[model samples]
Structure formats: structure tokens, C-alpha cells
Target: YNIHPSEKLIQAFRKKPYQGCCPIQAEFLFIGLDANYAYDIEEQKIFPKVIEYHKDAISFWKKYNVHHPFLLDGYKGDGRKYHKEFSKIRLTCEDSSRISFIELLHLPTTGRNNLRNTDLDKNHLKYIHQAIVSQYTKAVFISDAVFRLMKKTSTFSWMQDAREIEGYSLKVFHETSPLIYKHLHFSTYGKFQAQKEKEMKAIHMIISKI
Candidate 1:
């Protein structure tokens, strides 16, 4: 019997837990060739669908080879590896009551270039974004100005009258390094984020000391 690729992920995560940055029952994005898909920045678009309910599931990471981690040569070719990485992250960070939601209100306008200083294909990114919307409810996304830059042929179109998710708060920042494939970098955005949080707490400690 053939199982849906997604259904397989769901069943696996139920038996274990996720490690690293991915959230519990939280959705993610996958972008690559149709034959072997993975993750990309476009996955942020699915943020609206995941806020109300919590369930057990695993979302695929865009695969990368160990030989040339930066080049998009081939899929990692190991579903079990994906499962293990996610499971370990989930188990390690089981106490997440301290985390908070942050809305990327400017993504539709600015795109990933709004954060990173690189030009990327908007259509490819849109494909990844669509996948995210299909998976999770409260995923992060781009602003209209950012989205305009990612387009293929047209100049730019702003998504005016865009509405915010109910009961959600917004936080805008000049920089955003996401939590995808962060394990590859020597010091990943995940590490940097943790450091930033630690620094903030340290300042608080100093303030209390004074």
C-alpha cells in the first residue's frame, strides 16, 4: 500500500520528538526539484493555519548533501535522518512555555532580501511558501514590499488591505535568520538566536545587579 509522503512524516513524529528549532506540531516548508523536494524561505507563508490546534506531526526539511552543503546538488536521501533531527530537537526543547510569537509583517513587500542581502527567485520561493501554507497555520511570512522583489516578470505589486491574525502580536526587525538547515552552519542562526536571547537575559541580570 502506498502512503502519502506527509502521512508517513506524521506517523514517525508521533513515536518520538523533534530536536533543534522546529516547533511541536509546528509546520515547515520544503523546496527543491519535484523529484526530491526540501526546504526554502517561502515556507513562512503558512503561519495562519497553525495557531488554534496542537497535534503530532513531522515536516520535511529541504535536503542537502554533506560533501557540498551549500550547493543544491542532491537530496540527503535519508528520511530517517530527518526524523531523528526533528525528534531530537522536539525532545530537547520540550519546555517551550517561555517562547513568544513574532510576526513578519513586512514580508509580502520586502521578501527574504528584507533580512538577508541576496537576490533569490521569487517564483521558486513562492512554491516553498505555498507548501508552508499547506502544512501549518501560524508560520511566519514576508511583507508585500519583500514579496514584490521575489517576483519573476512583473515589477511589484503590494498586497494592500492585508489583515493580521486575530490575537497575534507583531514584531518587526531589520534581521531575521530562520531555523532551517541551521545545523549545517558553523554557528547557525539558531545558535545566534540563542546567544541573543542569552545576551538579553545577561543585560537583565546586570540591571537587577545594579
Candidate 2:
């Protein structure tokens, strides 16, 4: 009698779009993603999918002529965050083009009721840590940015690996820099959200501040 539902309930789980729903970060925050789940990037239509497997994505990025490798981290893995629930994409406009990195896995944004107390079981906690370590290694190897803003509230301090070195500053170097007021737009099924306007305005403010 649908005991399957109850059995699945007792087992551990990861939140999905079918669950409560995902909340995007505030308008001003930058976004980035890791490499593994890049296919999701195309499916989501967050941007045009770079083709030819690896070469095209890199080439499309280099097209802007602002090439620099940086470490990109996905989750802290300190029990404070769930890796699979928070898919991410990094956004930074440079040289007249928007730069992005696609990441998969993250904590659910839904409130406490959605979380399971068993999420902290030692095995579960270890798996989360392992995921973090693996992701961190890739980012470190590439020297991308961790996007610091996505870190869990406090379980562990989210720090970029020392090997990553310096990254681009939030402030644009040129007042007229193509990136200065570059607009990033988001749409859901051909319709735009009012939040997109706010994001644009906030970006302008950030540009003006720089």
C-alpha cells in the first residue's frame, strides 16, 4: 500500500526541483559553476552551450580575449552545506562578454523543515567532505574563484586554497570597461523576471562604485 513511499522517506535524500524549489542568490551576487554538470548548463539555458566538448567551451571563453585560469569551488563540505542540492553558475563580465563556470551540487535553500537530522550521520558527513575535497582539487588545479558568497553560513570557514593565488578584483579597472555596466539577463521560459531589472541596476551601482 505505497509503503514504498514510507521506505524511501526513511532513507537519506537530496532535494531536487521536485522538492520545495531552489532560490537564486540576491541580484548583486556573482554566479559560477564547476565542470562536471556542465550539461545542465545547456539544459537550463543559462547561456549558450559551448560545443565540441571541451575545446569549444574554452575557445568561447577565450573569444573575449580575457583569459585567465582560476580555481572554482562548489561546496565547503563541512556538514554546513549539502553539495548536490545547490547547482551554481559563476558570472563575471569581462572584455565585453560575460564569463561563467557551471557547478552542480549544493545545499537546499528551503527552510529547516526540509532538512533531515540524519543528514549529519557520520557516513553522510564524510561523503559531503569527500565531495568538497574532490571539487576543491579541481578548482585548485585550474586556479578559479570559489565565488565565496555561496559558502554555508558557519559550519566551517570557506577559504580558497593557497595554490589559487590572486583572482580578479570585484572592482572593474576601467570606468568605461566593457564589463563595467555589462548587463546579465535571466529568463524563465521566454519571460523575464522583475528581479532581472534589479540585478542590472545593482550591477550598475557596483560599476559606478568601482
Q: Name the 10 consecutive residues with the lowest summed lDDT in model 2.
A: 17-26
Question: What is the C-alpha lDDT profile of model 2 across 31-131, one tens digit per residue?
Answer: 22222222223333222222221233335334533222111232122212221212112233231122222222232222212222323234433343343
Candidate 1 residue lDDT tens string, 132-208: 34334233333333333333323222223334333323222111223121112111245465643443343233223
TM-score of each: 0.24, 0.25
The segments of candidate 2 whose C-alpha lies over 4 angstroms from its true place after superposition are: 1-29, 32-49, 56-58, 61-98, 104-192, 204-210
Count clashing pairs, candidate 2.
22
Q: Considering every candidate listed, which one attains the maximal lDDT?
A: 1
